[model samples]
Target: MAEVILFYFLMAFILIAALIAVETTDLLSAVICVGAIGFGCALFFLFLRAPDIAITQIVVEVLALVILIRVTISRNATFVTGDREFFASVVSVVILMMIFLMAVQVLNSLPAFGDAVFAEVTDSASKTYISQGMEKTGAANIVSAVILDFRAYDTLGEATVLFTSVIGAAVILRKRPRKLPEEPQI
Candidate 1:
C-alpha cells in the first residue's frame, strides 16, 4: 500500500522533472532535470520491485550526466536556443496531454499487475525457458539466460555498434592539426 503511494509520488516527480528538462532555459538546470528524472524513474521501478531495471536506469543516468557535463563545460553557449513560438508550445502541451491520457487508459485496462503479475509472468517465462532455454543459451543465469539465450546476436550487434561509436568519437575528439602558443590565463 505504502509502496503504491510512493510509486505515484515518484511517477509525478519523474514527469515533472522530465517536463522541466525540456522546458528549462538553463542548460545546467535542464541537465539536472534529466538526471533527476532518471533517478526518480529508477526509484519508481524499484518501488514496483524491478531492481534490475532500476539499476540499469541509474547507471545510464550517471553516464548521461557525465557526458552532458563534459560537453556543456566545454562551451559557453551550450544552453542557448532559439525561442519557441507561443502557439508551438501550446500545441506541444496538448499533444503531450493526449498521449498521457491514452497511456493512462491503456494502463488502467491491464488486469494483471502488481504482485499478482510476478508469479504469473515468471511462471510462464520459466515454462518457456525450461522448454527452449537451452536453444536460447546453454548457460543457467536466468536473466542472462533470457538475454543471451534469446537475443545473443542482437546483443552482440548492439555491443559492436557501441564500441564502434566510442572509437569513432575518441578519434574525432583527439585529432589536432597543430599546437598553439599558450596565452595568459585569465
Candidate 2:
C-alpha cells in the first residue's frame, strides 16, 4: 500500500516535471526540469526493485544533465511563441494522453506485483542464473556472475555503445577553433 502510494506520487511528480520542461521558456529551467523527470524515473525503477536499472538511470541522467546544462549555459536563450504554439501544445497533449492510455492498458495486462510467473518455467535463463550462477562463474554475487561472466560480451557491447555516445556528444558539443586569415605576399 505504501509502495503503491509512493509510486503514484512519483508518477505525478514526473508528469509535472515533464510539463514544466515543455512549457518553460528558460532553457536552463527546462533542462533542470528534464533532469528532475529523469531522476524521478530512476526513483520509479528503484521502487520496482530494479536497483541495476535505477543505477544506470541515475548515471545516464547525470551525464545528460551535465551536457544539457553546459549547452544551456553556453547558448543564448530565446522564446518564439506564435499562433501555432497553442495548436502544437494541444496536439502534444493529445498524443501524450494516447500514449499514457496505451501504457496503462499494457500495465493492466501484466501479472500482479510479487507474482513469480517465471517459477513455472523450469528452463528459463533466470532460473539457470539463480541456480548455477555462483558455481559456474565462481562469483559471490548472482548479478556479478550474470553480467561479468554469463553475459560478458553483451555487457561489453553496451559499454562500448555508451562510451561511443559520450564521445559523440563531446564531439558535437565542442567549440570549433577559429580559422586564421592568411597574409598576402607583395
Candidate 3:
C-alpha cells in the first residue's frame, strides 16, 4: 500500500518535472527540471528494488546534468523556440503520452506484483538463459554474462562512439593557440 502511494507520487513528480522541462524558456531551469525527472526515475527504480538500475540512472543523470550545465554556461541564450519547434515539441509530447497510456493499460491487464503466473510452456528463453548463461559466458551473473560476453561487440561499439564524442568535445572546448605576430622581415 505504501509502495503504491510512493509510486504514484514519483510518477506525478516525474510528469510535472517533464512538463516543466519542456515548457520552460530558460535552458538552465529546463535542464534542472530534467535532472529532477531523472532523480525521480532513479527513486522509482529504487522503490522497485532495482538498486543497479537506480545507481545507473543516478550516474547517467549526474553526467547529463554536468554536460548540460557546461553547455549552458559556455553560451548565454534564452530557449525561445519559434512556432514550428513548439508544434513539433507538442506533437512529440502527445505521441509520448499516447504511448505511456497504452503501456499503462497493458500493465494493468498483466499480473499484479507478487502474483503467481502459470504458463503452458515451461521452456522459455528465460529458462534457457538461466540454465546455459553461466556455461556459455563463464560468468556467474547471468545479466553481466549476457551483456559483457554475448553482447561484447555491441557494447564495445557503443563505448567507442561515446569515447570519440567525448574526445571531439574536449578538442572543441580547448583554448585555441593565439597566432604569434610574424617577426618583421629582416
Candidate 4:
C-alpha cells in the first residue's frame, strides 16, 4: 500500500515537473525542472528494484545538467516564441498525445507486469540470464553481467555518443581571442 502510494506520488511529481519545464520561459528554471523529472525517474527505477537503471539515470541526469549549463552559459536566460511557433507546439503536442494513447492501447493488449507472455517456453530470456549470466561472465550482479558482458558494445557506443556531444558543446561554446588591429609605425 505504501509502495503504491509512493509510486503515485512520484508519478504526480514527475508530471508536474515536466509540465513546469514545458511552460516555463526561464531556460535555467526549465532545465532544473527537467532535473527534477530525472530524479523522479531514478527514484521510480529504484522503487522497481532496478538499482542499475537508477544509477545510470542519476549519472545521465547529472551529465545532462552539466551540458545544459555549459550550452546556456552565453545564451539569453528566457525563451521567446511567436504565435505561429506556439500554434505549431500545440499541434505537435496533440499529435504526441494521440501517439501516446495508441501506444498505451497496444501495451494494454500485452501481458501484465510480472506475468510471462510465453508459458510454454520453460526458460524465458530473463530466467536464462539470471541462471547463466553469473556463471558465464563471473559477475555476481545480473544487471552488471548483462551490461558489461552481453551489451558492452552498445554501452560503449552510448558512452561515445555522449562524449561526442560534450566535446561538441565545448567546441561550440569556446570563445576565440579577437585579432588586434596593428597601427602603422611613423
Candidate 5:
C-alpha cells in the first residue's frame, strides 16, 4: 500500500540522514541532517497515531536546534576541545549502554508489562479510594485521593525541592548585568 511505501521511504531517508549527521565534517550540515531525521521521526510517530508524543518531540527538536545554534554562535563559544576526548566518550557510552540494557530488562519484567500502568493504577485507586477512604479524604477525585491521602507530605516535599532547585539554578546561571565600557582616554 501507499502508506507502507511512504513509511519505508521515510525510514530510508532517515537512515541516510543519520549517517550523514554522524560522519559529516561540517557542523551546520550535520545539524541539518539531524533535524531532518527528527522531522522524519515525528512524521512517523504521527502516522502511528501518537499525536501527543509526536508533537512533543517536534517541539523539543525545534527548541534544541535553536539552542544549539545560539550556543554555537554565542560569546565565549570558541570552545573547541580536540576530538582526543574520544576515549572518555567511548567509555561513557559503553557504561550508558549497559545501564540502558539493564533498565529495559527490568521494565520487561514488570507486572504491568505490555499493559498501560496508568489504567491499572487509576482503576485500583478509584475502587480503593471510594470503598475505604471516601469518608476520610472526602475528595471526589479518586486518583487525587490515593495520591494525597497517602503521599501528601511526600508530594509537597518533592514540589518544594523541585522549585528550590530550579530557582537556585536560575540564580546561579543568570548572566551578571552588563557594564558599559569605559570611555577612551584623551
Candidate 6:
C-alpha cells in the first residue's frame, strides 16, 4: 500500500515536472524540470527493485542534464514564433498523457511489491547459476561470478559503450580554440 502511494506520488511529481519542462519559456528552468523528471524516473527504478538500473539512470541523467544546461548557457536565447510551437507542445502533452495511462494500466497488472513469483521451469539458467555458480567460477559472490565469469563480454560491451558515449559527449561539448586572422602582408 505504501509502495503504491509512493509510486503514485513520484508519478505525479514526474508528470508535473514534464509539464513544467514543456511549458516554461526559460531554458534553464526547463532543463531543471527535465532533471527533476529524470530523477523521478530513477526513483521509480529504485522502487521496482532495480538498483543497478537506478544507478545507471542517475548517472545518465546527470550527464545529460549537465550537457543540456551547458548548451543552454552557451547559446543565445531565441524567441519562439507562430502557433506551430504551441501545437507541438499540445501534441507532446497528449502523447505523454497517453503513455502515462498505459503505464498505470501495466503497473496495475503486475504483482505487488515483495510478492513471491513461482516459476515452474526446472531447467532454467538462473537455477543453474544459483546451484553451480560459485563452484564453476570460484567466486564467493554469486553476482560477481555471474557478471565477471558468465557475462564478462556483455559487461565489457556495456562499459565500452558508456566510455565511447562519454568521450563523444566531451568532444562535442569542448570549446574549440578561436582561429586568429593573419595580419596583411606589407
Please name the candidate that would achieve the greatest TM-score relative to the true structure: 4
User: What are the Cα lDDT values of the candidates?
Assistant: 0.81, 0.87, 0.85, 0.87, 0.77, 0.85
lDDT of prediction 2: 0.87
Off by over 4 Å in 6: 78-146, 166-186
Alpha-carbon deviation at 102 in model 5, angstroms: 15
Q: Write the per-residue lDDT of candidate 3 for residues 1-186, one digit (tens) a residue.
A: 988888889999999999999888888899999999999999999998777789999999999999889878758575656446788979988999999999999999878864535443488666666689988988888767766887789889999999999999888888986689999999
Q: Per-residue lDDT for 1-186 in model 4, tens only?
A: 688788989999999999998888778888899999999999999998999899989998998899787766678645645335788979988999999999999999988665667654787777878889989999999988987898899889988998998898778778995579899798
TM-score-better candidate, 5 vs 6:
6
Q: How far in Å is the alpha carbon of 42 misplaced in model 2?
A: 2.8
Candidate 5: tens digits of C-alpha lDDT, residues 1-186 = 677788888899999999998777667667778889999999988986667669878998998788667655544534434465788989988999999999999987776533545556755754555687767788765546666876688879978998998899788778996589999999
Tell me the TM-score of each prediction against the true structure. Answer: 0.71, 0.74, 0.67, 0.77, 0.46, 0.62
Report the lDDT tens digits of candidate 6 across residue range 1-186: 898899889999999999998777777888999999999999999998768779989999998999888878857773333346788979988999999999999988877656634334667787788789989999877867888899999889989998998899778768995579999899
Of candidates 2 and 1, the better by lDDT? 2
Q: Tell me the tens digit of each residue's lDDT in model 1 across 16-107.
A: 99999888878888898988988998888787767778899999899999998887776778666766898998999899999999999998
Model 2 lowest lDDT segment of ten:
74-83
Q: How accurate is candidate 3 locally (lDDT)?
A: 0.85
Better of 1 and 5 by lDDT: 1
Q: Rank the candidates by TM-score, best first.
A: 4, 2, 1, 3, 6, 5
Q: Which RMSD values do the candidates have, in order? A: 7.8, 4.4, 5.6, 5.2, 8.7, 5.8
Q: Give the clashing pairs for model 1.
A: 136-149
